[model samples]
Target: MIDALVNGLVILMDPFRMLMLFAGVAIGITVGILPGLGGLMGMALVLPFLFGMDSYAGIAMLIGIAAAVPSADTFPSVLMGIPGSSGSQATIMDGYPLARKGQAARALSASFMASLIGGLIGAVALTALIPFARPLVLAFGSPELFMLTILGLSMVGVLSGSRPILGIIGAVAGLTLGMVGGAPVAPEYRFVFGELYLYDGFSLVILALGLFAIPEIIDLMAKGGSIAQRGPGLGGGWMEGVRDTLRNKWLVVRHSLFGVIIGAIPGMGSSIIDWLNYGYVVQTSKDRSQFGKGDIRGVIAPEAANNSREGGVLMPTLLFGVPGSSAMALFLGALLIFGIQPGPALLRDDLDLVFVIIWSLAIANVMGTVICLALSRPIARLTFVPFYFIAPVVLCIVILGAFQETRHWGDLVALLGFGLVGWLMKRIEMPRPPLLIGFILSGLAERYLWMSYNLYDWDWVYRPLVITIGALCIGLVIGGIWLKRRSAGSAATASDNDGQERLADNRAGEEAQKGAQS
Candidate 1:
């Protein structure tokens, strides 16, 4: 195994392979910076070019693209409140707020640093776990997977913050939208209303762009100022952001591992990994006030998780020929195109190739981070540019992105409809993250629930993993409630103390004035 590892490293070091890797990283970053163009698109564009390329170099280039995307996508999410892709959606919660506070440099740097560390950790974990992961992967049956989806939905409560009812309503709305298309188990559609577009359901790109991007654009244009409302300069330096990530080292490690575990699940895509991590951090923290208002920890958690999950998703794709997520599905196809069979025999015959992938992922992360850091100074300047100047370009890009979903007119209509809904929700101060989370998980939950029933009927509920996950879900709810109440109590006590102190100060001022008059 060590010899194969060394040989793989040696192969990756070849000049042409390194150049291809760099080229892939550049393409990945470019696509990631553009809203709605993710690693999947980049992968599709590069697929045909790999027809007769060296197998090692081709795969290296693909790995480089995958590794760079999660890090690069943070640019749009932080600077403009636009989700560069689904993976960076959670980052916008805190990151964009920080940008508005003139801390764009800080937010961008911290996210890049976390991505670098998380990518390295994921590579190490993948290297260590691949040999022993087969049994663990097989342990999660349909019942257990169903429970996991429920676990993800439970986060809606924590994400909703002070408005639990609104959160629940939003989640229901999202579930309804998710059910609009053809049923997984049944032959009929649920809410199409005879519209052919409804048969395919809403694209995630359109939903996300409409919900978050359009609302922000409208608000910015209406307000008529720069994205950084506070000032013309970045209030904090890049080193400060680096320090923030270092200060939250444990958070980076914890969520990166969480991302790895979630990514290993076949149907659990990148869409919900960051949300789960964000909700978990909020639930566990003692002080929950600064989260959506630009806490650096929020930036660290999701950025770390999104980058690390790339390595985890590869576990199933390589070991079982089961693609863990959509991007991995493309990767699996690429492997087949290269005439390299995945699964057990591939491991036995081509272990060296596996190590090459690990090497490429780790190195690409480093290259991506350094490049982002170098670009942060200039890119961060976007926040200081007036919204009027930036709005037209952003609006055009967003429209283009939404249209690409299906190249159908329905995409634009949905975009406008959801954009209005999102604007209303924002005006009302309703939480939007829960709705996105619910929509992403709804289809998976339905599929898994039916599968469990078909396989074991009522008996599946008694499975140990199912019971364990259910208990964990219950615990999360109770714990979130407890933490929220404690935070409220503390705030009340602090307010009372301040009131008493002000009263005493007023009395002292009166006594002093009376003495002077006398």
Candidate 2:
């Protein structure tokens, strides 16, 4: 194992691979700073170009982009008041407020620094976990893996944000979408509707654009403002933000661990980790007043978590062929294209590729952080660009990018159809992440369930691991609801206390004035 890692590190250090990594980081940062396009689009954009590349080189580039995106996305969240991706949404809460107060550079710098540290720590943690990784997959038969899918379903409780029914509906919608093609074990098609395009189902690329990008394009163009609504204080806040990160070093480490832990859970690796970290920090802190009002800790926590999640995401992705997120789903596809299956066989034979993946993530995180820091000064200008101009180009890119995937007219129709649905979803706040998550898990769930029946009959339900995982899934659902309600109650109590204090102060002033007049 050590030898494989050393060889993988050597290959990553090769000049050609290093250059590709640099190129990928550059492209990732560019795409990440854009409001709607995120790392998923960046990876998809480059996917077609990786056909003839070596596995090491291809994975390096993809990891480079994947790791860099979270680091670079802070720019828009802090400066433009727009989340560069779902992962950065919590960032805008305090980061943009800091920018509004002329501290954009501080926010951006701290975010990048936290991202770098968190990513490095996550990579190291994954390295430590790799030796034990095989046992986890080996222990899980079809029953256990199927229970894992149900555990994934439990995450919808946490991700839905006060709308569990909507979350369930969105997940069902994804499962429906996943069912469009032929059944996993049967030859007959279910929802093909006689269209060849429906046979293979919608390409993930088209779904990404329609669900994530098109809605943002429509919103950006409609808003039609400079990306940054306020002047940024980039003049001297870089060092200050660095100092802030240093002061809050433990906070970054704690949240980074949270990111990794949550990420390792089957369906919990989505951007929800970012908000979870932020919320955790806010709830535990002695002084909670500054959380949503330009606090530097806000910038640090989410940045650390989002970046660390990428490394943790690779664990399940490599060991069980289960993707932690939609972006990772694409990664699984890319691996298959390279003739590498991602489960036990790959672990036994292509161990070096896993090491290569680890090295790429670590190096890319460092390189991406450096690149973002260097470009921070110039990219601040992006926040001043008019959305009207940016919108048209992004729309064209999404439409054209969809076509580039399958080179078919049906892709266009799917793009428009899902685009409208996505826009409506945003309006109603239906939580689009569940749709993607469920879609990714649906096929795995079906196959695993079928295999469980064939392998163990109905007795699979009594298996120890299956029962344990199932119980955990139930706990997650109950725990998520309890946590949400408790947090809401705490926040309400605080608000009421503040209101009562203000009322008391007002009455005191009135009584004092009356006494003086008497």
Candidate 3:
């Protein structure tokens, strides 16, 4: 096994292969930073170039592009409060906050660092877990997946912060919106309102833009300033981000492991991993009030988990011939065209190829991180630009991204409509993360719920994992409510104590004055 890995390094280090790998990495970075165009599109674009190419070269380029994207996807997520990809939705929670505080470079640096560490850990895990990966994946059934969705839904309570009522309303609103296009379990459309665009429903890109980016842009315009309202600096600089990530090194390791396990399961993609990891971090941290407001650990947790998930994504694809994600699905097609099939047979017959892919992923992660770190400080300078100059361009970028979903006028209409709702939601101080998350998981949850119902006729409730997750879901909600009430009570107690102290001081001063007069 070690010998295979060593041979892969030797092959990857060859000058010609290294050049191809670097080119793919560059392409991946570009794809990631561009709104709505992510790893899936990147793999599709690289497919035609694989004809008659060496298997090592083709696979290296594919893995190179795949591995490099998560590193650069942080760019828009942080700098613009727009998710660079669906996977980056959670990143905007704190990453954009950091950028708004003039720490764009720091957030980007920490994200890249986390991605690098997580990617390496993921690759190592893939190598070590290949033997047991199948059983681990098969352990999860429809019931388990449904319970997972419920687990994901629990995040709304965590994210709602001090406003659980508003959060519940926001999540319910999102589920309604998510159900607009087509029914998950049936053929009925619930909220299309008779437009052709309504048939496909709102794209996730459109929702992300309208729900988050537009609101941030509107606020920037209203405030008449740069994103970094403080001043024109990158804050504590990139090294501070490095130190911040190092301080949370154990967090990176723990979440990376979780990422690998979660990623191995189908339908549990980066969306689930990123948010779940973020919620876990927030839930476990002692000092969490700073989370949505530019905390460094917020940047670390999601980035690490998402990057690590890329490795887990590959395990199922290679071992089970099941693509773990859209990008992996495209890459799976590329493998077929190249006469490579993924299965136990492939692993037995093509051990070197498997190692080569894994090694390429790790090496590309290093390359991607190095490239991002070198460019981060300069790239971070964009946040210092005045808002009026920046807003129109970003608005156009988001508009274009939204339009790409269907190339219809309706996409723009949906964008404007949702944008207004988002702006209003912000004005009311309602947290937006829970809404986005609820919308994302609602369809998935409904699908799995239906599946579980049909498969086991409610007997799935008796399953041990389902019961455990259900209990956890209940506990999660209860815990969030308890914390909210406890914190509120503590604040009230402190206020009362302060008032009593003031009254006592006033009485003492009056007595002293009377004594002096007497």
Candidate 4:
């Protein structure tokens, strides 16, 4: 293993490969700084170049692009209250608050430092885990996969507030929509509704673009503003934040570890990992109450965890051929396009590629961090841009991304369809992540169950590992329900108490006024 890794490192020493690495990281930083253009879109746009290049160089560029995007994405989250990437959402809760309080530079610095450390940690983890990848891949089965999906769905509780019903409805809608193209068990068409375009049940990228990006743009236009406006005059020396980040190295380490573990688990992506880490920091810190309002550690934990998750997610992908999340699924496709099929053989036969991936991730992080740090001041001024220009450009980008998924008009129709759904879901307070997760995993779950039933003759359900995972899934679902009910009861009680207090004050004021009049 060490021999293979050393050889791989030597290969990366090529000036051309190094230059491509730097170029990818630089582009990734720019993409991350721009709202609505994320690593996935950037990679998709660049994928064509891979068709003409050496496999190593092609993969190297994509890896570099992926690594750098998260580093730059933190800037938008911290400075403009806009996520540079989906993974950076947790950073916005606290980071944006800090920026609003005139600490935009500080927030960006913390995010950059966190991304650097997290990326390095993730890269090292990928390298260390390479030897054991084969065995881990062999252990998982259909039942485990289904349980993992259920667990991922259980995170809706943490994501939604006050309207879990609406969230559940959106999730059900997504799951049903996911099933529309064909039956998972027998491959028979179901709900295509006589249209050839619906046979594939809507492209995942189109759905993602519609569900997340389009609605956000529409909402921005409806509100008549740009996120850039909120970020005005909020820039200065980021080095001070870097210094502050170094002082809190331990927090970053702990959060990175949290991210790595959560990310390693299949079905649990950065969304849950970030929120979970942020929640932990709030629970553990002395000044926990300062979290949502603007605490640096609060911002740092999520940024570190979000970046570190990329490493953790790649673990299963490189080893098992099973993706930890959607982004990794796209990466797996890229690997396949390069003639690398991920499985036990990759670990034994193509270990060099594995190491290259690891090292590339690290290099990308360093390059991306420096580039984004330098560009943050200018990017911060984007918040000052007028809404009229920003809205049209963002809408065009969203439509282009949606159209590119299948190169079909129906995808554009689907994009608009889901855009409306997204708008409605947002208005009703539905959590979007759960709906996205359901859309992603529903097909996988159904396929796995059918295989477990037919191939295993129902014995799969009785397997000890299956039983354990299933029970765990059930427990998570039950726990989610319990938390929801408990939260509702608390809110109900608070509402009642407030109403009573207001009525009492009103009566007392009336009585005093009558006495004065008499």
Cα distance off (Å), candidate 3, residue 52 = 1.7
lDDT score, candidate 2, position 81 = 72
The positional error of residue 290 in candidate 3, measured at the CA in angstroms, is 0.9
Model 3 alpha-carbon drift over 4 Å, by segment:
131-236, 377-518
lDDT of 2 by residue, 1-518 (tens): 99989988988888888888888888788778877777877886676567778877888898898998898888888877777877887787788778878888888889999999999988988888878877666767788878877766666756677787898899889878888888997787988889988888766667767877778788877877766565644765788888898899999899998888777765553456776777788788999777776789978998999999987888777876766666786687678668786766567787888888999999999999888888777876775677788777767767877787678899899999988998999899897767876776787788889999998889999998888887887886777666556545544543454466558779999999999999
- 1-518 per-residue lDDT for model 1 (tens digits): 78988998999999999999999898788767755557865665576567789999999998989999999889888877777787887788788779888898899899999999999988998899866854554567778767766765665675566787898788788777888889978998888899999998766657766777778778868977554433334466799999999999999999999888877654354656776777777778999777777888988998999999998888866775545565665576578668886655467688899999999999999999998898766654543556688678768877876776678999899999989998899899897756665665677678889999999988999998889878977886676666545545543443454356558779999999999999
lDDT of 2 at 51: 72
Identify the candidate with maximal lDDT. Answer: 2
For candidate 2, the clash count comes to 0
Q: What's the C-alpha lDDT at position 464 in model 1?
A: 87
Name every residue pair that clashes in candidate 2: none
In model 4, which regions exceed 4 Å deviation?
3-70, 73-107, 130-133, 142-172, 182-187, 230-238, 262-302, 315-357, 404-406, 475-518
Better of 2 and 4 by TM-score: 2
Model 3: lDDT of residue 95: 86
For each candidate in turn, the TM-score is 0.59, 0.84, 0.58, 0.72
lDDT of 4 by residue, 1-518 (tens): 77877888888878889888887887677667767667765665455445546777777788888888777788778777777776777677778778877888888888889889988888887777766655665576776665555555554443454456666666677677789887878859988889999887766666666666666667667766554655455556578789878999999999888788778765454556766776677668887556666788977888888778878978867775555665665566567657786655577578898888887888888887877777666765654565667668767766776676668888789889888887777667676656765675677668777877777876677888778766765675466455445534533443354356558779999999999999
**Per-residue lDDT over 1-518 for candidate 3, one digit per residue giving the tens place of the 0 to 100 score:** 67777888888787878887888898788767755556765664555456777878888898989988888888878887777776787788788778887888789888999999999999999989766654554566778777766665564655566676787778788777778888989979887788777887666666766776677667767878544433334566888888888988999999889888777654354655777777778778999667777788888998999999989988866875545654665566567657885545466677778888898899999999998888766554543456688668767777776676668888789889888988898789897666766675567678889999998998999999789868877875676455445534533443354356558779999999999999
What lDDT is reached at residue 277 by model 4?
A: 73
What is the lDDT of every predicted structure here? 0.78, 0.79, 0.75, 0.71
